[model samples]
Target: MPLPHLLRRRAPRSGARRTARRLAVTVPLVSLAGVLALTGCANRERDAAPGAGTSTTASSAAQTAAFPVQVTVPGTDHAVTVERRPERIVSLAPSSTESLFAIGAGEQVVAVDNQSNYPEQAPRTDLSGYTPNIEAITGYNPDLVIASNDTEQLVASLEKVKVPVLLLPSPHNLDELYAEVTALGKATGHLTEAEDLVRTMRSDIDKIVKDTPKPAKQLTYYHELDPQLYSATSRTFIGQIYGLFGLVNVADAAGGTGDYPQLSPEHVINANPDLVFLADTKCCGQDAAAVAARPGWQSVTAVRDNGVVALNDDIASRWGPRVVDLVRTVSDAVTRTAQQG
Candidate 1:
């Protein structure tokens, strides 16, 4: 129901033209009910290292000295060469903005889109990722532009002006997430810091999964993407995180091919999931009580047993440094529900 969610559900198309299709829709895109079932389409480079539970310390100064780096855009063979360490970077992707800040490239970022709400100190601008404006973005005089998609022929247009652009899409899993972070490191000449951050994130996530208690029976959950009952199946990035705790996704039983599917109220009630994780608290004001109050929802196992977990919408949506926080939140919910059972 929020503007951010509408922006996230981009209309199906190629390149920046997708943004045009999205804006052309006369009616509002609410609850994804009007949109087609869409999965995350971005890709990341291969991981820098193999081990998932290892830790590494990095020297930022030493890494910054390495310049003229070339990074291949994920999902594409196109390689972008950064001639020097970028000093005035413009980030249009929220996840990339968070990754840039986490990998110690924060000082190099001159501006970010309006949606990059984390890190408190991000140089937030009115630049729109959904319907990007080349003139407005170029106004920042960016040496480099980072984006999630090629919305509006952003890459081609930037190339015309000779400004380097890095397109890192939303990753489908943790490995891909790591690769994106690593790629950002190379692009910004902070490869060591990016690799270090990835190692820590892997170690932290592994620990969280290991620390969670196995419930008496396999737990089933419904990940609420919106109050309209749009949910994520286990095939999704969010679902994979839940799967790490051995929790089953109820949406998987709905028999849809898309990672995201809109379910009817009766279907969710019939599934009777053991856990309900609401990612719509901010977007739609949904919480444990809000879910429980739904007609016939009182009969749901999660509602009756207080197994509803409220999640930060942004953290749940983005796969960046804070994904460790998302894992910990799921870990806490799993622990509490296991204990209750």
Candidate 2:
């Protein structure tokens, strides 16, 4: 699980509030046993172009997982010698379900994670690791079970089942995200399509960077996950989006490596950002005003200037086709400043 690091360098302090807001809402709505589900809440684009099996040798792991799934996704990495293609698949995470859907195998997903709610047509299967529903998952007679990793109960439950289980690592950044897409594509006999999609995503991003204003300032932002709000570190997907827009994320002050770091009231007051974007409002639970009235948040530009923006939880957390929307949202937030300049 040695993941690559990718995020902005200097994140805003006050914006750290955004993290809690996001996790609070998204985790419950999409959490598959305390871990965030891919919720199919796409941001509109991924960095890779929208093509699968397009070009460039995939990874050693990618080669090993070579298409036309045989048995099941090995619980281990790159253990691709399965017995058959996953015709009846059950997803334990929303993102895992969404990944299958993205590769044109939506019909194959017989059952979905409890939180899965994208495409508006996923089956209402009673599958969730929260309650340990092995019978429910097995009831679908699935050949493959795509479950989230790092869940003890979920992992243990899958091993007991005779079916093949593909344990996908939770995505921490862009490369991992792409890897997930590619791996899932191979399993579904859609590597070629996945490759194409990734390529198209990259091309689109290149265009965004080439066409957008490139003043050294980048965009300065404060992203909140909740009303009390924690912010993302310089190495998270949300943080990376700000980087893609050349926006300076001020959360780095409180952000850690893998996710948004918790911010103290003192820290929020000290490193106020230009704009504030709150993620996943469900976590706020009627706490925005109360959180807003807290000691030092009022001093931050987002609070004072009323620049705080509540984001769409579905599109912001999923990292699906909608990743571009997140970028666009960030772009618009920063564009306001560009216009004033």
RMSD of each: 8.9, 8.5
lDDT of each: 0.71, 0.55
Tell me how far candidate 1 lies from the true structure as C-alpha RMSD in angstroms.
Answer: 8.9
Q: Put down candidate 2 lDDT per residue, 188-287, tens digits, no spaces.
A: 6556656766665556556655666654455567665544455565565666666777667676766456465556667766777767766535434323
Q: Which candidate wins on lDDT?
A: 1
> Of the candidates shown, which would achieve the greatest TM-score relative to the real structure?
1
Q: Estimate each model's TM-score.
A: 0.83, 0.73
Q: Estimate, for each residue in 81-151, the C-alpha lDDT of model 1 and write its tens digit.
A: 88888999999877778778877688789998877776678899889886799999999999999987788
